[model samples]
Target: MNLALKDIRHGLFRFVLTCFGLGLLMTVVLAMIGIYNGLVADALAIVKAPAADVWVVEAGTQGPFAEASSIPPDTRDAVARMPGVAAAGAITYQTLEASHAGRTLRVYAIGYELGRPGGPEQIAEGRGIATSHFELVADRKTGLLVGDTLRLGRDRYSVVGLVEDATNTGGDPAVYVTLADALSIQTKLDPAAARVQAARGAEPVKRPTVAAVIARMEPGADVGLLVATVRQWKHLGALTEAEQEELLLVSVVDKARRQIGLFLGILLTVSAVVIALIIYTMTMEKLKQIATLKLIGAPDRTIIGLIVQQALILGGSGWAIGLALILTVKDNFPRRVELEPFNAIVLAGIVFAVCLASSGLGVRAAMKVDPATALGG
Candidate 1:
């Protein structure tokens, strides 16, 4: 007879209740892993959207995602004329809050020239922006739909298309418009600000500048050569796509990653402690039975097997429950929760190791129960 299974069946309700509680704890651990993955994904979304090989920005600054960067609008033309350059587009980025559908919507506005490399690669719904003046392609996360019009700055723009999962590092949904319209929206001051500027007799603001110029190189082109050529322009800095992604991971989300890792460590420690304590307590409650088995000449291995088996069942059941819960509710999270199969597999391995380690305490307690204890009590 399996002593562990028999004991668990004797207290099935309690065993299930304990597993439920541990399941909740495991849910939190899995969620943290997913949230960390989501943070990295969100931070790199915009940079990867354009699929450009080279990014040119104002000299002495990182690309637009990390810090402020503004280069001349004509930078695109200069880069396009360089050898090995297949295409180039000047793009601007800004974060703005606008009133929409009785709520304030925060969005990251992107300006790209028509017939350029910076536009959205595919439209999920409707059509791409065809007009230069007031059309937009918005991320579906912005709650925008085709034919919906929203006022931005001094003019109104109509949504012509929708894209999925397009967001900036700050998690704001992205909207795409023509370069001219973006410049117009960005430069036009509100009436109150305009009045203040008029009172000061400030000269009209110069034409709005672009955040960066992105270039796509021809197949088999020397990316290093193009980056070097852009860097020698005296007023421009260039980074390849890999360098830009590294900069973002190191600069933009490094602290968040560290924070999540710390939390995961803490949670795992707590889980080990809780499992050890639970097993120890269960062993203490069954000391007499263990003594009886010893008196009947049961071997030490049988007793050890009982403790280890119970711990594994508890941990394995809890982990399975937690995985199910997280998968069901992951999509409802405000920010993305990207859980991969590999992440789940790694967690399972960690939990298995913890279970084995935790059973040591119960094993120790069961071994100390003297065979005489069963004769006395």
Candidate 2:
């Protein structure tokens, strides 16, 4: 009684094969969207991790996450002494390659004042660094395990703890060590270079300072007032959490985000064209059958329903398979792939609309089939 059902049942293998192929394409599209979300999320992770209200960095330079920013380490004490400042800590960030366990690891070294504003708020395993020297809390993605010895600069450090998903915007794993240790690695003079400077009568290099200051506000404190006060320093800049996030989104990853968006648009366009072509081809193949049905007094609506049903089925199956694929291997990806529920819902809606629009080609072909041709044949 149902012509669409009967047709699909007769060509079950082909129908399923088409869906499988379409599913693979949809999976790729979904993965790209997930990657974009992951990129933005990872970029903002450090700002979110600090849970601070104010970020103070060198004046006229965006923080290191967006660009190079360096400030004196002693600025933390100055900022802490300011009115309405609940706590202040110095944070230094640098990208370094360290050798550990016979492997080279690229890590973002963070210098956090333990038990202060700059340290990670929570630890996933073991304990936060309790010693000032040679202990580290590293992101698990670094493949670092507790008790593993890492050679950073001229000193050796032991991984004392691990955290999950604590990666920098570039997906590099973060290694949290004491402020002193980070300072040494960040600006530690190359012994050979230091000797050369000494020979040239240049004073031996002193420890370089931090890149930024993270500060928390007291309960019910006015952040605006605090920032205005800090701005008077003339050599420093202060940003609230919202401002920092905006800077990252607009400055740090804008091009990448736009690039991904353009790719997604192209993929959707290609998908629509491919679906329309497939439906149009299928409709052409069944011209005689459609003519016969029309001659038998079947309505145009029935023909339209058949084509639309196939499109919907194709798109729906593809979406399901794509979602499944993203879930199965997302965690294994080098960079984070965050597939949120809202993203899935929006993608599903897009595919549905595309399927409906794609059916237009088949609808036109079916509507043009002549009932007279069936009687003559």
Candidate 3:
């Protein structure tokens, strides 16, 4: 008795094809949403990996991640002497390109005190750097496995461990080494360049510096008060774990987030337009049936229900298809794609509302089709 169901069944093949095409569009929309979530997660990965209570950097700067910060390596020992500081470690950061197995990989280099506050929280394979020098803990994304040795700077390092999701805000996998090794690589002069400089009566610059000094507070210690005390030091700046995350999100990845949001907005708008046009055309093709129903004294609500029902069916089916498509290939993306349950549910609600709203166009056109059209046909 339902006109929409009857018509859809009569043209089932066309209806399915339409849904499949619409599903591809929905998949694109869902992928955009996943990409934005992934961007935020990726940006926070390394920042959250270290289990430190507070971060201390150079004075007058938001160093470590947001900006360049080079503090005396001894700062770690000094910070450890402060009240309420249980432990401290010096950490350094830099970007380096290395080649392995005929492929070049961009890596974010992190130097930290061994067995300290700055090491990765979780290791998926092997063990943390046990030998100190020339032993590295690498993110699995770097395509390096345990026992695999790669060259960085002038030194060769063996991959001793692999960590998951340990990448920097820039989406490069992180490689961890001892503070001493990192300093040597980052600050050491190239041998050829050093010789040229020496010939010119210049000494190789060797400033012992670390990007930041990380501190862990004792049980029930006040992080705010500790940060305040650290900041009182003329040569130091400090922030809590929360503040560090905020700095990365609000400053480091802010532009990329805005760009992704704008792109998502455009895709949603286009989806609405496409849905409206599809419903309108489908309604146009059913004009004769609409006129026949009107001639038989069917009420306006019944005609409206027919168009709305068809629109919902199409949208619901498309959403399902899109979900499948996105899941099948989500892992294939170069960057991470995180599709959370909350986001998917929220998108579903919006899609349903759009479906109902789009049906209005079809209902309006169907209502205007004169009953006299049935007589002519």
Candidate 4:
């Protein structure tokens, strides 16, 4: 006769209700883990999109993503002429808000030269930008579609293509345009502003600048040598892809990672406390039955097994329910929720350890029940 199973069957309704509540709590814990993974992925999305071997930016600054960087638009030609350079492209980055279809859309605007290394790698729908000006390739998250024309600055641009998972570190969807169009959109003045400038007799704006120049090296080329060569130019700074990613993680999203980790720690501590309390309460409620078993000469191991078994069942059932709930609703989350297999496995292990540690309280209380208590009460 399994005393733990018999007891649970007797109070099946209460057991199910308790598991349901714990399942909700577990769902929150799993969601936090997924959210942290998503944050890291989102932070690195743009940096990884280009797949460049080296980044060239204004001297004395980190890459364009971390801080302001501007280089001459013609820097692409100079980098391309360097030995072992397979390709180079000038690119610019900016954030803009534009009104469209009765709503304001915020986007991260990217400018790249045609047939360059900085454009979207693949288009999920429609074709890539075919014209040098007034054409746009937008991320699907932006809610813009092919043939949809939106006015930006002094000119209008038509959405010619759509990409997936293209967003900046700030979670804004990305839009791509030719270098010429992006410069015009970014530097052009409104009619009123242009008139004021003319009245002041100010000279026309100088040629627009690019945020950075990205270069792809030939296969088996020495990346360190190229970086060093660019650094010696005095007006330019260079970083390999690995260094750029590290700078972004350390400078851009480091605080967010720390905050989420602290929150996860708090949640796990609370879960352990709640499980311990629940097991202790259940053990107290069955003290007389435990005493009866002791009077009938049941060994200490049997009583210990009963408490431990019940604790495991509660925790295991709750974790299973929570995993199901998270998987079903993860796609609906505003930001991505990336739940890898390793993350789930690690969480399961933590939960198992928590269950065992929590059962200690119940085991301690059950061991103290006097055999005489059964006869009296």
Which candidate leads the pack in lDDT?
1
RMSD to the native, candidate 2?
A: 1.4
Clashes of 1: 0
Write out the backbone clash pairs for model 3. none
lDDT of 3 at 294: 97
Q: Which stretches of candidate 4 lie over 4 Å from their true place?
A: 204-207
Taking every candidate in turn, the Cα RMSD to the unseen true structure, in Å, is: 1.5, 1.4, 1.4, 1.7
* Model 4 agreement with the true structure over 136-208: per-residue lDDT tens digits: 9999888998999988777889999999988887788899999998899878887777788888997445368
RMSD in angstroms between candidate 3 and the native structure over all alpha carbons = 1.4
| lDDT of each candidate versus the true structure | 0.92, 0.88, 0.89, 0.90
**Which consecutive 10 residues in model 1 have the weakest lDDT in total?**
198-207
Error of 3 at 213 (Å): 0.8
Candidate 1 residue pairs in backbone clash = none
- Sort the candidates on TM-score, descending order: 2, 3, 1, 4
Better of 3 and 4 by lDDT: 4
